[model samples]
Target: MPERSLILRPLPPFRLDLTVWALRRRPENRIDRWDGRTYCRTLVIAGHPVWIAVTEERAPGAPRLRVTMRAPVLPAQAEERVRQTLERLLGLRVDLRPFYRQLGGDPRLGPLIVRFKGLKPPRFPDLFETLVNAIACQQITLTQGIHLLNRLAQAFGRRVKDHPEAPPAFPKPEDLAGRDPEALRALGFSRQKAQAILNLAEEVVSGAVDLEAWEDLEDAEAIARLRALRGIGRWSAEYALLRGMGRLHIFPGDDVGARNHLQRWLGRRRPLDYAGVQRALAPWRPYAGLVYFHLLLKKLEEQGFLQKTTC
Candidate 1:
């Protein structure tokens, strides 16, 4: 199939960073690897996968952005959906105009302008691979969970290309429909994890679960539907809703990292329970997802996840 390319100009800085951060989480999403030049990631849209690459190069006039998107799907409608997905992921429509005006004159927040200058919300997958990996990881350490996901991908996912360094695309529902549960078990998936994965796959294959449509639903409805699945509960549902549908208000309160960060941010002596989390985040409203991302970034910064980037 011939590839189609689209260029996006003046991309938001925060959104670009967010996209890079997300792609770094898993190898399958690595769309390009050019040191100090460009970064890229792949995403599946309308069942057709595509690569998006962005680079900022010094130009004679002004700093220029070069964005190249290569996809098999070519219609304007499909392109529009991809564009909307990027916008939604980056929270571009929320209009921080008021916040900018309010803080423009404030001394304390003035410095934050430089730090947070062009930060934008990130784009992520409709179905969160992390959430699924987390459910399979329950009570296990981060290392164990990552290993399990790697194994799962190797066992069931397809090898679309043999890029020696990059992992393969995770198996789709049909890829695992006929596999024996024992196969996953042997791959170190707990019995419960195997069951949940199989159940999810069956739901996907049977058309009982529609991730795309679910992405457009309200948070409450989306969470309710996710929880209806046998293996998915509050944590999994919230995680999935946040990643899958961009529902910002729903927090996986069970995440120890989130709880700890909230504790410190609120100056609370004790850990926060679910209700406490809800109350604390009430002020953030519809943009709670952005808040969560910020908090996570803050925690990562504190923990030395990456060299502290200003703001």
Candidate 2:
């Protein structure tokens, strides 16, 4: 089959490179691949594996993207599915103007926000993946966590047979629902984590849970419901709210790395606990998650994985 192409116009001040780096976080993330120019990812669409490549045709403030997809059989509505998924994943339609205006004259976070103007808060395609990520990353370094996820994807995720070089898509619930925990354990998941992933997958597959339904609930209600699940806790629940539901006001205060980033960026002498994180970020209410994303980009830039550019 031939590759199908489409044109997309994201809101201005959108830089695909910056947005991708924010979504990918590290160069080692196999699931989201960025090689200087184009951003490529394998996605499962309409029961077929598709390889997608997106390139920016114009700079920020007049942004345009050329999206190309190659699949064994192009499904009906494939273009629309790809468009909506990319729009949500890349935050193509989100306007950051109000956020920028809110940061005016702020001595602490003004420069940081200005430095990474086009970065958007990216999300997992669904709650199942978000929960899996939170479980995989609990109490571990991000690098190790991403390695475990890559292994999971390589093992159970759908692959495009035609493009062996492209990484496999993140596993869907059906892909993992019937697997034994031992299988996940072999891929570097702890016993508890393995079981948690399997349990969530099974719940999704059996229709016992509709993870997407939480999108309609308020933040507190959603968090409460999420915490009722076996493996989810405060941090995981909050992380899901921000990353899965795109609730920009909910910052995962219990995230040690993010807390450290906030403390250091604020020049606090003492290390911040959850309470301290909230108190310090109270002034930036409703946009603290945006701050979290900006801080993450700053860290990635410092580590040489990404570079700052004008929007």
Best by lDDT: 2
RMSD of each: 4.8, 2.3
TM-score of 1: 0.75
Alpha-carbon local distance difference test for all models: 0.59, 0.88
**Tens-digit lDDT track of model 1 for 1-311:** 34554444443333355334433432222222333345544445555545555666554543345556565454455556656655655454545555446554545434444455555544344463534665676777655776787677667654423233433455567777667889999999888888888877787788887766777777788779877876778877787766556565566777666777777877899789988887877755555555566666555445654342321
Candidates' TM-scores?
A: 0.75, 0.97
Candidate 1 lDDT for residue 232: 79
lDDT of 2 by residue, 1-311 (tens): 65899999988778888889888876779898888888899888888989999999975458899999998888888899999999988988888888888884578788987788778788888889899999999999988999999999999999987778878999999999989999999999999999999999999999998898988899889999899887899999999999888989888999999899888888899999998998898888879899899989888888877853211
lDDT of 1 at 244: 55
